[model samples]
Target: MPRLKAEDAERREAAGHGPDFLEALARGLAVLQAFGPERRQMTLAETARVVDLPRATVRRALHTLVTLGHVESDGRLFRLTPRVLRLASGYLGANGLSAILQPRCERLSAEVGAPCSAAVLDGGDIVFIAYGQPARLLNLTTMVGLRLPAFCTALGRVLLAGLPEAEMDAVLAQHPPFAVTPQTELDPLRIRKRIAKARSDGFALVDQEAEQGFRSLAVPLRRHDGRVVAALNIGMHSERGTATVLRDSYLPLLRAQATDLAPQLL
Candidate 1:
């Protein structure tokens, strides 16, 4: 086993306590997550810097991952392999929410003449679990596992509103809002108020906050126990008119779908 540096060990201990914490497993996962679209391939030294771990530690993790077929390496450069998708597949298969929602999302997208998606909050981001698009080309393309900022998207607002106040506050504190677009509200107080409004209104409408020329509306999807587990949203071009028109036209549809699917989820 490669020895973790003193500072790295201290940071890991602080982040994950208890004797049951497997430091090696945590380090491996961290190393895996360090790879992203922007960083498709990297050298051992580059990966070590990104993960803030010693080169030896990262090298061992990469070796293990390569042996397991989750990573590919060519002497000097390392990259994740398609086999890594099995990890995400396992979660989706076990949860089954994506499977149940995809067909409904497609139907909704066709009816609305726009894109429809379902997402769940993951850390400071919202991960799209299911998505559907109209036959016509749209500026935005969403797919399963696409991650977006939770502070700026209607889907994110609704999902964040579903969290308890304390939990929501903790998340906001941890990931203070950043500007995804000029329309995105960077003020934490205003963002909190927006989330609060979503909680009370049962739906959220965002105009051009997530992307230029794009607008979206979202509503919470609850489980059988009335606990919100995810959010459903529709995205369209900003030319669709003002926020009021979006709310009036799409809010009811979103709410209806959410309600219809609530009994099926859990």
Candidate 2:
């Protein structure tokens, strides 16, 4: 596949006429964007290739970012430093969606005696934004900001079901809906049918799809305008209950919390 180049050129052209827009600053941001969970450490040439810029240009940007303490290098590979987290901190800290949803997640967790989370679909994944868990629940391997596959996760299915049919088809086509577990729906048509069921039912119950021993129940979290902006879900240990118990017993609790969280999305 071609390297990710579409956004870099677009951002530069959009910045062309802005009086205060800095090309160096934009390139520096691009260099930072080149790094992610999969590419945490990259050499200058690799960064240049990923950002679709010349090696010298990326090197210069990396040097300036190193001076600013946003990036660090040990003479081989460059990696972002903790200072870069400040940029994300400002956005997540802003009073609104997360602030409102997290408390509801906490209350929902307490009421159900389990872990609960709210996530929004981004690209082919769902990024966790808010969470809550009971004390007795074992520590989880996941945290806020973690991204999970959209096709296999209950949260992702509920969010995907909210999209218009054409938009949903487009997304499924791009992503291929690859199976994450043996039970996952690998066929795009089958996955579309599953999403349709979720749309009609107003929720999704994924049974051992994302993981072997876990299942999930999820519902759409809508805005005041009745647009689903995110999904709220409960992860369960499959051994604890059957799918019928998961839906009939615990699904209502999730739906109720989802109702409370919907209006806050505005």
Candidate 3:
């Protein structure tokens, strides 16, 4: 197959997609993501290099972003402002799934005596929107806006398993491999095999990949139309339960809660 030119990809993507869907939104998001924890303030040249866009394009995007209040800049440096939070907040406020699933997640956590969370796929990471824990001690310290690599987390795998094969391939291709932990799978073939297993099993069990002692299991939450909107997960210490324990004991509870909450998602 031939690679698509930027203009061709944009045309194909826009033909049937929403009016708001466009390559410009993606490029703008890339610009915003260029400013992260380590590179909070970036010069125009640095932003262009990081986002892999032309300096002129990056500058115009930055100017537009600043005008929209999503970014702020001094004469020489640009950084994301708190106004960016409104974009995320708007998503949470608009999605009824978080509110509908929070109670079920809490109940599941109480029943399993572990921490339960709900996350939606945001680009290549899973974003936590709602969570409940037995105690704050066992928590992963993840907040509503925290992002984690999709390939290493159970919540991520479950969500990824629901995506179209081509889309999943494109996403994984971007970060072919990165070692988040010793147990992380960096091999594409192995990752594909695991995703296939998750697709067949209807759940994903990630063992100590995100952190040394952390293990998590997740099931996809589907909307009324049967589209997967998010994932629900229960995470615990490695010592707390074996992988077998997670599969045999906790998975059923998680599946039950997901089934119960599915009706509320749409």
Candidate 4:
């Protein structure tokens, strides 16, 4: 596919500008996102290519990020530093859902002997804000601000299932499927069917989709106004539990947590 032109992207952003708009902030965020797994240590040219910004623009943004200690460059390669976590930490600290859901997730993890997490849908992915794990040795290293595909994760599916059908379709249309594992659903029709089932059942179960041998079950966390603002999930190895176990044992606990958390979210 052809790369998005820098001028075109700038034009699109200019069209959206308002009196209170911060275009510089938007461009900075775009630069940060450009340094993902594939393009981790980008030079100025590569950063511009990935972010669809002019090389000069990206150079300035990198300099600003470096000055702020959010990014570090070793002469040629540039990458984000741990200071970027501060930004996500500030957001999570200010958000009510993370505070309320943290204790509930811990309780659920203790009760179920599995890892539990609460995540919010962000664009085409889910971002885990709170998590708990009973087994300290379990190698699930995901932390707050880690992003994963929405189609393959139980939390993502639950969030997507809660959306209106039209909105769900729009999101799916934008994310043409990429296989993360053999069990990952790629067909749009099949994904729609799975989402429909989740909507009706009030939960979502994903097995070996995001990663090999990983299984998870999730329920939507609805607010007082009945809008699903997040998803609660318990993750474990598929060999450790069956779908029936998830439905019979974990589902009720997750539902109860979600019910208790609904009132606490703003």
lDDT of 1: 0.89
Clashing pairs in 4: none
Q: Compute the lDDT for candidate 4.
A: 0.85
Candidate with the larger lDDT of 2 and 4: 4
Query: Which pairs of residues have clashing backbones in candidate 3?
Result: none
Q: Give model 4's TM-score versus the native structure.
A: 0.89
Give the C-alpha miss distance for residue 236 in model 2, angstroms: 0.5
Tens digits of lDDT, candidate 1, 109-138: 999888899999998899999989988866
Taking the tens digit of each residue's C-alpha lDDT, what string does model 2 give over 1-266? 13434455566577674445566777788999889889999999999999998999999999998999999999989999989878866767983777887888888888887778988888888988888888797775546777888988899998999988788778777787666788987887788788889999999999999989898999998888989888898877888898888889778887777776665578
Q: Evaluated with TM-score, which candidate comes out highest?
A: 1
Per-candidate TM-scores read 0.92, 0.82, 0.79, 0.89
**Model 4 per-residue lDDT tens digits across residues 133-191:** 88654665656677898988889988999888889889988887799999899988898
CA-lDDT, candidates in order: 0.89, 0.84, 0.86, 0.85
Rank list by lDDT: 1, 3, 4, 2
Q: Which ten residues in a row have the lowest lDDT in candidate 2?
A: 1-10
Clashing pairs in 2: none
Q: Show where candidate 1 strays beyond 4 Å.
A: 1-13, 138-142
Q: Candidate 1, residue 215: CA error in Å? A: 0.6
Which has the higher lDDT value, candidate number 1 or candidate number 4? 1
